[model samples]
Target: MHSQDKLIMIYGANGYTGRLIVDHALEKGLKPIVAGRNKEQVKQIAEEKGLPARVFDLDSVEQVANNLNDIAVVIHCAGPFSATAKPMMEACIKSKTHYTDITGEIVVFELGQSYDAQAKEAGVVICPGVGFDVIPTDCLASQLKDKLPDATHLKLGFDSGSSMSPGTAKTSVEGLAQGGKIRENGKIIQVPLAFKTKTIDFGNGEKNAMTIPWGDVSTAYYSTGIPNIEVYIPISPKGAKKIKRLNAFKWLLGTKLVQNFLKKQAGKSRGPNEQQREKLKTYVWGEVRNDKGAWVTGHFETANGYELTYLGAVAVAEHLLANEIEGGAFTPSKLVDNKLVERLPGTGEIHFKPE
Candidate 1:
């Protein structure tokens, strides 16, 4: 369906990424209804953008469900999704409305998956991690599996400019507070924050990446039937060293005080500003190996990951509006066609090498 006739609601529409999604949605000719707990903020945004706005408090499930009626889909952009996802998913399923979000929280993802049967029963699709946090890696893993039928081990890496938004920084802090995980020996294993580090070359240059708990650990396993998967994000050597040292005090991760302290520190240490966000580029690299002593490596470069996230969210909205998606909880890799990667707005240069 074209965006013009669809009634799409953007929850948390006042946040940095949420505002970008709203702007992109409007540019695509969609009139998005911005919603969040902050009615004043959302109202101000709507008034400025000439869009509609609503107030949605997660504490009130009935109100959320009431608001979901007649909406084509709800794009839940407010995160640390661990707290928001379950209630939102329940509301969508009850209202028989499609739902999508940019959440990369593994705990949130697992909780969403638990509602798959309910969503299917209600004929409502629940798709999560429809953003750079996992979509590229998830889609790439699916593509690699299609190429190598027997591929069993998956390693995905990416390096991008440091110009991250406030929401991204908050998400990173949340991830640091909650340690990451990786699939090893065909089983899921908890990993200390910044447990593993390696250098990844993105054709243009090389950068060091540390293991981060990416949502793909949940998505790729079911999508590609791969038991072992890991995702890494390249960081500066100095940052890597600092992370390594911090990881030694693993007990600190369990305390909310420590998490808040780190969050404050991250906010204080500015990386890139708005101009840098416009100029920054992102490069992704993936390697798939099997037990047969064969391996395949692929590289892709695109605009900044945040921009990709906005486009991906819009793509998801389009799919839901058109009824192109099946009713169930799914990751982007499982719900969308690999070919749609071409339709997605961005220049993705992909190359594969054999080893």
Candidate 2:
């Protein structure tokens, strides 16, 4: 139990993933304060759960910190975090509150790391990418990190047969303009989409995978000290061709008119329904190697990514509130033990293997 009677505040509580986390909290009988920038939407969800609600923008760091008064840990579910994370974190640091968010954007990881010393000094934890974006991959990196302790390079990948949430889709649209990125020798390097391709057997079978600028590009470097990192995702041949074309026209995608049109089209749909989400499965794979050519591979199969976020984020929150974890700007892997995903509540839904 949390000793201080401090609340777990769910910022952006009305978001697709945010609402799920709220439900999970309620189901566990852990009372969390619901909050967001939308008054009506946040109030409705808060009313439904009988939880306290706060409505405010990131415009005022003072107010954000004031609102976090009784909160011990915050679950920030809003995105594209590239825009939202900075302000929220700035406020959290000032408020001296532990912060965690379901962010996959590499920019957010970089932002968090930049505040590492401040977070430690403030006696607060700043952990982002607690979602599917990297938790599972972060854990797999640890597995491979242990397997090849002197590894200098890391390759991590995941495939989940799940629908994209509106927030996830929005983030993708934002990234379309940026192309792709990878971390090399402790630096982030931009590349065109599909810069590299490989075949990965994510337990079920081998499939075509494309290098992507997943969160691990930042998190893995910090978590395992692997200086070179690349993350991949399985895509169809058609998907590959589509991405190549998008890369060619990325500049146009960056234009306000095109981005607005895409956003409007994207806003039409929400995330998956419960039936759809529960049926989805996720897979993660990682390989780490040294200059000696020695390498190790690891795999993990888990429940739906969104569901895991609810579980993973809440568990991390409990750990934070209990001071079972340390204060720092941390990736999920670094803040928690080696097998956090396996130790989580829904562990029955996960399978892990090493080779």
Candidate 2 lDDT over 1-355, as tens digits, reads 1246677899999999999999988887799999999999999998988888899988888889898866789999988899999889988888878889999999999999999898888888999988777788898788778878999999999888887788888888888899999988889999998888899987669999999888899989988999999998899878887888878798899999999888777777677788887787777788888999888887767778888899888888877876755567988888986688777544343333433
Per-residue C-alpha lDDT of model 1 across residues 32-109, encoded as one tens digit per residue: 999998979999999999988898789877789899886878999997688898889999888777889998887877
TM-score of each: 0.92, 0.95
Per-model tally of clashing residue pairs:
0, 0
Off by over 4 Å in 1: 1-5, 236-238, 265-274
Clashing pairs in 1: none
Tell me model 1's lDDT, rounded to 2 decimals.
0.80
Scanning candidate 1 in windows of ten residues, the lowest lDDT window is 266-275
Candidate 1: residue 59 Cα off by (Å): 0.6
> Candidate 2, which segments miss by more than 4 Å at Cα?
1-4, 324-326, 345-355
Alpha-carbon error at 139 in model 2, in Å? 0.7
User: Native-vs-model 2 lDDT?
Assistant: 0.85
